[model samples]
Target: MKASELAALIGAELNGEDVEISSFSSIENISEGSLVAILGNKIPEDIYSSSAAAFLAKKGADVPAGKTYLFADDAELALVAAVNALYPKKHRDGVNPAAYVADSAIICENVFVDAFAYIGSRAKIGEGTEIHAGAVIGEDVEIGSGCIVYPNATIYDGCRLKDRVIVHSSAVIGGDGFGYYQKHGRNVKIPHIGSVILENDVEIGSGSCVDRGKFDNTVVGEGTKIDNQVQVAHNVKLGKHNILTGQAAIAGSSTTGDYVMIGARAGVSDHVNICSKVMLAAMAGVMSDIDKPGIYAGIPVTSRKGWMREIAYVRDLPNIVKRIKDLEKDKDA
Candidate 1:
């Protein structure tokens, strides 16, 4: 696409001569006929010197002389738009002969079941949904319209997924939760009888697992995006638009309010409540309820400010101990 055309597509303002862009690339790897976006406040010298054909920059960003520039309110967002326009996702339109769909399964119009995919008995696949090759939809599973279950993803029996949900490769939905009981010096397994409900627009990352409930549904609210390797335990309720980063784990029955952000490697203990807009910093360990919305960090999770202060004081402990010893010697003298 030409610079002016791309700018019009992204609703950006154009400056300098129009240039043809065939692809999108990073600044470091950009070549002629490729476009790149400048994300930082200042345009780097390397980016300015690169042989890129066009640039997507933030409004009011400085442009190199004679270089083509397209200005957007958010350069990163504009990059997403440019990439999508350059390479649109191709969806298969119909079921493949090699797919094993049960006779009782209800597949709606425009749904695509790829080769070797399995749709179980009484399963209902909504319109325009795509079940990629090697994916498995267990018995009685209900998947809504326009969803995509990527290759090798598995949705176990009786789980429900709303519209536009994306289950990345290797994701295990409705898997058994980690529950056990002590019995006569041995561990006994607890049965998870309930299902998982992934609301509209939710995306489960690759290698992530959302466990089924012990007696009721494990519900992930609408617009929530879970990162790779995350674990959502049985009966845990995640509110709308929450972001759980990679390696984060929520223990059984814990509930979080809308717009919560749990950083990477954070752990939330069972039965704890996280209020709306709460931000749990990386590696935070929450053992109790968070009643107020704010940034939290550290084990047993304190406010971010308090945690910083505690860290500072701990760093000065050795000096304080030495001073106390010197004072004792002076008194003795």
Candidate 2:
């Protein structure tokens, strides 16, 4: 695609020759024929030396000379569009013979079911889906079109995976969550009488567990991508396009806003509400509701800047105490 053509497709303004470009990449690692995305105020001094054929820049950004610039109101959106255009999915045709599909199940055309795959009774598999080897789709599960269930994945009964959903290897969707009660000095288990609802374009990474709700549905909104080893507790409502990094855990009934980013190993307590566009740093433990959008850190999870300052003060505490002791001895002498 030409630079001018990409601008038209992404609703951006072109500022040089309509040169043909094929790929998208970051500024620092821009390949020779790729389109690089640069934020408005993030143009590095070395950007002029980049070998990228074209650039995606925020509107009103300073365009470097001798390079083609495509001005977008939002550079991130332009990058997403360009990547999607350049690397559209390529699906396989027909189901594999090794798949063990139940006779009562309904499978659509052009689907790929790999060896040892099991589709349970009354299950509905939509068109263009690819279920890899060793995957088990439970009874009455409804999987939408263009979805991908990777190897060794398990989808429990009555779960609904909407269009374009991707479940990676070893991910256990619609599993019963950890909900137990104490009764007469003994542990009593609560039966999970609910299911999981994964909306369109959601991706569950390998080894992740998305538990079913207690009485309702545990809903993962469209375009959300959960990373490996993450645990999403029952009844959690995750908004669209939220990014959950590796080992992140969301307790039961917690709700996160759209476009939220939870860093690796961050934990959100039950019943907490994190507002839109908020970012939680790695290992941060959130115990309260975050209604404002900003970067957060710490165990109790305060502002990232405040946490940095607190760390600085703690680092200087020993020196300050030694200096104070010396002054006191001199005064007493």
Best by TM-score: 1
**lDDT score, candidate 1, position 61:** 74
Worst 10 residues of 1 by lDDT: 40-49
Candidate 2: residue 114 Cα off by (Å):
2.9
Q: Extract clashing residue pairs from model 1.
A: none
Give the alpha carbon lDDT tens digit for every residue of 199-229 in model 2: 9999999999999999999999999999999
User: Looking at candidate 1, what is the lDDT of residue 11?
Assistant: 81
| Local distance difference test, candidate 2 | 0.92
- As a TM-score, model 1 comes out at 0.94
For every candidate, C-alpha RMSD to the true structure in Å: 1.8, 3.3
Off by over 4 Å in 2: 2-4, 13-15, 22-32, 38-52, 64-69, 181-188, 257-259, 271-278, 288-295, 327-333
- Model 2: residue 323 alpha-carbon error in angstroms: 4.5
